[model samples]
Target: MKKKKMISVLLTAVMAAGVLSACSTGQSSTQNGDNAPNTSAGGVTTIEFWAAPNPTQQAFWQTMAKDYEAVNSKVKVNVSAMKESPTSEAGIQAAIAAKSAPTMSENINRGFAAQLSDSKALVPLDTLDGFQDIVKSRSMTNTIEPWRFADSHQYVLPIYSNAMLFGWRLDTLKELGYSEPPKTYSEILELTKKLKAKYGDKKFLWAKADLADPTAWKRWFDFYMLYDAASNGNKFIEGDKFTGVDKAGLDVLTFVDSLRKENGLLARQVTDPFENGVGTFVDVGPWTFTTWAEKYPELKYNVNYTLTMPPVPDDVDPADSKTFADTKGLVIYASATKEQQAAAVDFIKWVYSDAKNDAAWFEQTMLPPARDDLTSNEAFTSILDQHPELKPYAENVPNAIPPMDNAKYNDLQTIIGEQAFNKVVKGGITPDAGWANMKKAIESALK
Candidate 1:
């Protein structure tokens, strides 16, 4: 699971899908809190929680909020739903711009969290009780450095992580003579080629690209994970800094171009694994699996897909097959009342620590848990244990990294993708020329 995301393009898609597509809730234009006193007349705390606009998620979240409210009648929690489909992220910006934001919401990335943190929009949770313990548990088992999340204070908490793993038809692989997933990039390419030759028109594409920036960018990042992270001084982050666009960046884009232009082993930008069935192997996450499992049950049995880490570079450590995980978490807003914020924290903690809370979420959703103790919880172990092919891909998780978050990085990537990536892959220019153009565009953006 390598890290890549196209936020701007996707944001616009959201706009087309209508501002109301993801979730249906009331509209408010400011960070309004509980102006009303408690029923006891002692004190009242109210906060608004903005989150992914998924309708399925609404039930679980609202239930949790209601429970919290029951315990603290003085504390009111309004969980506003905004669909991410058409333009959910925009609502965040729009609400903030209109000065009508909720008390708590989190729209984060490893690189972008700082922007919000610096603006004082997010509260520091470092001083909260059980925060350090939660950090330790998450760090050791998940292999994520908790300190990596630290800003001036604790702006974001570690949430469930998602990664891009190889999904394939298990029976098809065996029919093609690959008893297991390949261990290297070249191996997979070779395997896919053999399968392509056998299937002829029925292809086992490595991946498909989407105009949506995140989907397109993730396809690129997952390809990079097939290489060595430190082979030629590759490191996504150095201490508290982002370190992309060196040999790793070059090697990443080079491989991507090679995959599309040279190999032709991947499906095109518009192929959907669910609708078209044009591809065999696809890159996706757990949520995608859940969607497929539910929305298209007829295709479920056909999807014997599993996870495998991106291959190690030829010269690098064989054991270091890391995954690129870009997932979401909960962050309280600075505007939230202390009691309301505490209530939010309590809801979050219960999910991470209590079995009942964990069960409710798992029953409601198919998310991977953030804590290891909870991995044994029925959600992961059952399906994963039965599907061993998913094991190899699961190895990449501990090493997951977030994609670049700098605003300049975003603009530079867009320019490079438009000028170099799309052009080279679609055969508009020579690879060398495309590389040079990308380099120039990025440098200009930096300046």
Candidate 2:
């Protein structure tokens, strides 16, 4: 009953050709060893694990694999970075088609996991033994609640949840007679007026090309963050149903339209605008701290800038504001054998059973571990103390919402930018018209 055809259509002709060329050249990330889900001699269950094509991530997984194998002699995990011919997703699709897919892989986001689940490419992680144990041991009960797919099964075990926040130029806000960043739309508009009066059009509220790009993933930083706050974390889409709140969505569009009218937005591409003081505000992630510490050390947190959740509507409570969660997780492939699946779950359980491992993950990756008690737990106190910039992320872990679990998320998110957000920012459409148009287009596409 599996629909492998669905996955086959995911990659375009150009990407598929690249995958084929890479495979022929022995450039594929999957090793030449037997990866067909087989148990080796001595009843050892060998599982291949594809880590994200990142050096830090690959190094972490390789170390973990060696440590895990030392404790559990019956299971062997070969960790390798996934090939990114053009993208890691394409490489995974090629592996599945060639029957060389790893037993499990990390770097699986909720939206992409929905696609994999629809094609029956992933095992329902909730059905696996030790699933609840992992949740309890990792202290991620609340954090993992939103990861359930539409099918009522958990497909991905979330590793990190980057609670996206907005960073404001603290010096700029002080210059505008404010002590902290604005947390509501009305407050932001007032700040915008003061900003324009001071800097004219030379500076913008936000200077980012992604605002006008209409790229699917770009919506995560701009649209989803604000929409989540305005909607009070309402679901935009649920199981092929358009569940977006009309009032909340329109409020977000209207907020953007007002900023555009005030010349507060600069949709053109600008490098390091926030750091260079060309943009007063921009979406901030925990991953950005390391770069800032090295390259733009002058942009100190709470000194030169400060982070806050996305601005909410005037009527919404700013204290309860929510934002998009930039998260990814681990998923076991359905093609794996029963032995391999069991072993994979066992490895995950062992990895998460100790809070020290989570602390190590946080220290090494700088990505906040997906735990509800990140700020409260003593294990993470040292890391947060060392990296104070990440404290806001740890505190707001529960306030971040994961992306919609829809197989058509790519099309759905693109529609949000193309029909509504981009149009409102460009003055091509009224907020009301943009909202109506986007809703119609997205609902039509959902069907």
Candidate 3:
């Protein structure tokens, strides 16, 4: 009851203290390339692109086409997309059955990139002309950051990324006399309790726990990464050469289980969570832009959100609080011919690396830019200006750990979510036993 009032007062006070950030909740940025229908010239090399209509993706292809076409008048590009293949095998199947698939295509970023990596169907992007300089200096730094690694060499062109931190309702925390948000993992637990206890009679609540949404998985991935940011940290995805999983990582995972404990301290929308305030803070991505925020504008004044990262342990280095990164890259299709590659790269590079659309883009589509450069662009300025607290997730890119991965990506998260849910939510297993069950299921599934 007190925490809610404190948060509310703090939220209001923050405005006087200069609380200017975007109030806009963001939509999930998809491979939503701005691919539009284009006519090709006979003498020009035409690259066929098959993708879904991503009305809200960052670095839209259509915008890129205008610039690429302006320079490569001799090269032509054609793009078409269907809906519903996002998590389905249809895209791959369609490619397999096609007379000839698009010379260039959009991938699932990680999973699809992995597929392309496995099938050897994609061109080595680093070999493309002018790629070395762009990747080595600008693109890799400005774009992919640490995500620029390839298993063998440089095979992917990373365009954008995502990370997890924390977001809580400032209004809900005001009753507790808190003026700022928590910065460490242990602090998050304490703050969670504070909010739960503070908001007694107020319409505002603090902190919702995320569960089972693919959009929310970045936080789950980040929680474990808080302990270690290295590629194979926590052994979430074991490579043949590395052996590392620490107690800190286990604690984070267990904490996640704790979020959904049946005693009901946590929040999940199994039946529309945000609607009921099951838990105010949720580990989520931009999807909340449409799901929760747009529908309830008043909620913005009540809740303040930011990315959820590992808080600095009382005894540990604050830098170590950062962990886990979600890499979203652009994958060029292998079937794209030598000639098509020329135009494709030009188009992709221009939008991802150059075009500025925070206002024209996000405002029109209700989405957020994946580019670090545009986080506070005019379209999103109102948001960043008011909610300066979002900086943790926005700024933690450098220390981000990688998103979850397994041979069968879907099956992996499904198993983890199930094991943890069964143990913590269903009362069927202990946390340790649940983790053991997760490891066993993962190993068996791998085999």
Candidate 4:
């Protein structure tokens, strides 16, 4: 409770401070006129693009900007790393409050984009010209459908989606007389019993400290992953409504509770539990392979480990399971001029029209491109051949569910952990009580 309250107070303070700064600087709450229409005297429309503050992402955008400028002389793209004062989101918020936000940025998630859109700070991408062309050309219609906001507007152009998966120690499963990892709750429970009967306290199905942490983002890898799979990608929140499936949420909590009963969960602070083989199963993302290559080279894909979507409920089809998407995308600020907006969209369309660009992105950054044909596209075949572990993520891009498009997603997700998931994991509450309390709290929060 203190942690949540403290974070709320800090965010409030930051926003308030931004308002004060704007007022002191003689700036209005609205965008300054000088920030728009940054066109050169030569009739070239200039758009500022703030890339995510990372070396690889910055390099990718910088290269793309140079390449784009070489072909199209009418548009100028200036790429720079987004400022991260404490955090990138906070920096963006501060910039918006001061009315100096970039023309477009590439690190926006659906939830934060919702907050921006609610304040009318974002331009709806779907309403822009040539938006459908980009969708058709990139072959991302199905993959981009879930990104639509409650207002039926597409505010973001998703670049990469890291479909969350579970990595199981295949060697350990083999030692337990299993060739593959379990895919359903009952199957996992049965495996848990055998694991306990053999290794006792030395092994666990999952050993992650974040399970008991009430941090908002922690829910993505644990609760949301399982809940999405169990519910088959149900949108837990649509706009301001708490639309989480009751049965799926309860089943997820109950599954965690079941695992706890079998001594299959360890929500304690254990360093590198998955890599060290202390935990047989843990949430995996495409980004992990980079670290594995440098540190745990022995963790070969399909050799000693395998990746699959989060396990589903007993009755749900494991083959059709869905998981949460760790995704971020580009969004144009409404503060930009119409010309700049058009130019930004044109740049996006040009960048995505070619599959080789996406292939380069996948190769430079480990993140999977948000396209439906990634697995079948000849452009990506060689890349997938080099990194077989990424094939599942590519195949499941359409199956991955993005985060809720709610401005209060942080608070809502925290309630899930504090009222339901964390409590159940710690054996402090029954699944029924946890579900009811969580639903009530989330509904109240939504109101």
Candidate 5:
């Protein structure tokens, strides 16, 4: 991690005024600032930004805003903390409907961004100056493709990303006479069976399942991880239409069902497998490593843990093993004034253009950088070196698939979870029946 620098005189003055105001009022509105517009003094354009509620993220936005204000005195940034939840979408939508939306927002996922774009509420990033070049220089085409709508308009600027990866307890593997982790789904199945036989009463694998309320949503996380690997980057939707389940999807469902039945993998909810040493094998994101290090410092540099990209089915190409990349970025509102939009773009560009700021962001968030260049940055690489468990994330980024930009994703997920997943996993229905019901549900939802 890099050392913090002293704040500029101008920023210090502004922060001092805010501190005094809070002291006199016994509280500060800056803490929430949601939907509340700030008045810009001295004819400066105030760009309202609703930021995610993460403390580090909020601090990052405020620091960037003050830095931008110091350089460009004509623009002032008013950042508000937005909670990351379904309610956030409603709040943003309400603001947009009232024509009082913020100039930009953080933590806008592809699904919500697409919804906003469909309603003509987003300013396409491609229409902004220097944005395309940043995409070409910093991000890969595959990473950006998921955010492009049917009209070829990109509505979000991705900043950070995370992907699912396979994790195994190395000490457990060695005790079981294995030198390496499974390479494919078939291998995992075979390994799980052996482990089950050896430890009949204990759980051998931490597979995804929801026996109590088995729904398509319960299986979605694992399904997409394998689906991306099987389909090799094909999205579930194309041109505002649902491309219903294919052979790849069925294969994944079958695999998941089989794991629960034969592998002694618990279908019930449990605590964090990696943290509590609950399972020999688990699938997780980058944050798992950070959490483990922070809670169990004794295991910080222990080589008893191994992390690798999720394995594909035996029939699928090994090189095609992929996982879903959860991308969060900034999005500008169509309701924003032209000047405010320009300022929003400038602020994002300034933050990403400098490697130091980008590196600091990764260090603070523990999320992988969206930019390709940042992978080679010493600041970023140094952190990876210290926490070797996070190395798999950077290695898997090249094959990571972004989520589909479908507004109906949430609805489709509920249908699949209830109609398809729960039925197949616990309702004594055949996989084919579940698949057919899922297809019908998706079709109905799309209409």
Candidate 6:
């Protein structure tokens, strides 16, 4: 998909709900009897669930619901597929406002989850019995830590997690007389210079730089990835302060500016550098590997890789590199009755608690499982054996940092990408000037 399409889709789903109301006081009569939790004549408690619109995902949930119903005959799952759009969350929020929210939501954006948590609209997963131990046994602490907010409450049960990494064509790098990809920003510049010298300036390293489009706010991935490395994993919000626009932020912007002006490494538009063979190296996620395996098998064989963790300055320790982490999972709405909430938790626990089921999810979705122990599961290990390059990405799980959880996350991303990154690269503004504009934009949005 185009960066515009992808960003627009992802953030549109996340922020479409607007601000959730803090007052969950008066119940709305607009909630139809069928929409609310209902007990059948046979005494089965029927609770509704909203599943992602993807056919495979919907099928998976339906199958799970059937299996769960067979096991717990007293609970009936009413699964409904969501509309496929960035504004899917708006529909869910509308249901919630009408006091008809689903007992459980199958897919939730991290930022939106944070908003729900802040508004007290989500049930605390930590309160569930043995939930802590299950999380510890199934997933890495770093991977799970992102869901735990300052209140020490985990609002969502993460199903899978992902991070950004550097992908390259080993053949191209070897032809350039380098055995390995660049490990640092300085090394990247040096390699870019060599590539330009060999193939002309038009054939520079291609990195996405489409900041003007709303959907392309993901362009800020470059900035956050680099800043994480330079800052040694310090978060933008430490306690209650905005620590993003700091020295590390300046360093990242300056480096990006240099990449654009000095090394000719940055692409000013959204282009597939790898498939087109325009870029010898690019930053991407594990999903790209799955895409290559399916559509471009030849390119998949030729590609070498590096996780973009520890993006440190030339003078800093390479071990300190960190990368942005994205986790997707389910959250229960607080509107669910005690019986409905317990049933929802039971379904989640049953699904993830089993090693085989977790591994099966990985096999089907090609997404890494949330639980740590499943890494050794036969199904998951077989996938790694088929594509060993994925091992490095799996190793990056420990270094993965969740995206900023602020309610204004989407707006902040747009500000950074448009006001700061776009200006420095395309408008000829200094990094300092760009940062000042970005800071103002973020502060205004946060308020």
| Candidate 2, poorest ten consecutive residues by summed lDDT | 1-10
Candidate 1: regions farther than 4 A off: 1-41, 72-74, 83-86, 106-115, 127-130, 133-153, 196-204, 207-242, 253-262, 266-278, 294-304, 337-343, 373-397, 419-424, 427-440, 443-447
User: Which is the better candidate, 2 or 6, if ranked by TM-score?
Assistant: 2
lDDT by residue (1-447, candidate 2, tens digit) is: 011122222687764565445334432223334443345668888898999877878888888889999999999999999987756777897786575778899998888888677767788999998889999988898889878777789999989999999999999889889998888899899999999999997888988877898878888889999999998888788778899999999999999999998999999978889999999999988878777889998888789899998999999999989889999999998777777889999999999988888888888888898999999999999999988989999998878889899988888888998999998899999999999999999989988
User: Where is model 3 poorest over a 10-residue stretch in terms of lDDT?
Assistant: 1-10
Model 5 per-residue lDDT tens digits across residues 176-258: 78898877778878877877887774655663334335333333355566677777766776546777447877776677677
Assess candidate 6 and give its lDDT. Answer: 0.66
lDDT string, candidate 6, 277-333, tens digits: 766666776667667667766775434533345346787788767776655778887
**Residue 111's C-alpha lDDT in candidate 4?**
87
Q: What is the TM-score of each candidate against the true structure?
A: 0.73, 0.92, 0.71, 0.94, 0.84, 0.87
Model 5 misses residue 56 by how many Å? 0.3
- Root-mean-square deviation of candidate 5: 9.3
Tell me the lDDT of model 4 at 46. 81
Better of 3 and 5 by lDDT: 5
Cα displacement (Å) at residue 3, model 3: 32
lDDT tens per residue, model 1, 196-311: 67876565455465422333354334433433343332434332454444555555455556556435445356546423455656656665655565775545432454456555
lDDT of 3 at 234: 46
Q: Write the per-residue lDDT of candidate 3 for residues 339-411, one digit (tens) a residue.
A: 5677777666554443353334444443333455445335456655654444444455545555443334556
User: What is candidate 4's lDDT per residue for 1-447, written digit by digit as tens?
Assistant: 001122221247768566445534433223365544445548998888999987888999999999999999999999999987767777887887667777899988888888777767788999999999999999999999999999999999999998889999999999999989888899999999999999999999999999899988889889999999999899999999988899999899999999999999999999899999899999888888888999999889999999998999989989889999999999998777787889999999999989999999999988899999999999999999999999999999999999899989889999999999999999999999999999999999989
Best by TM-score: 4
lDDT leaderboard ranking: 4, 2, 5, 6, 1, 3
Model 6 deviation from the true structure expressed as Cα RMSD, one decimal place: 3.6
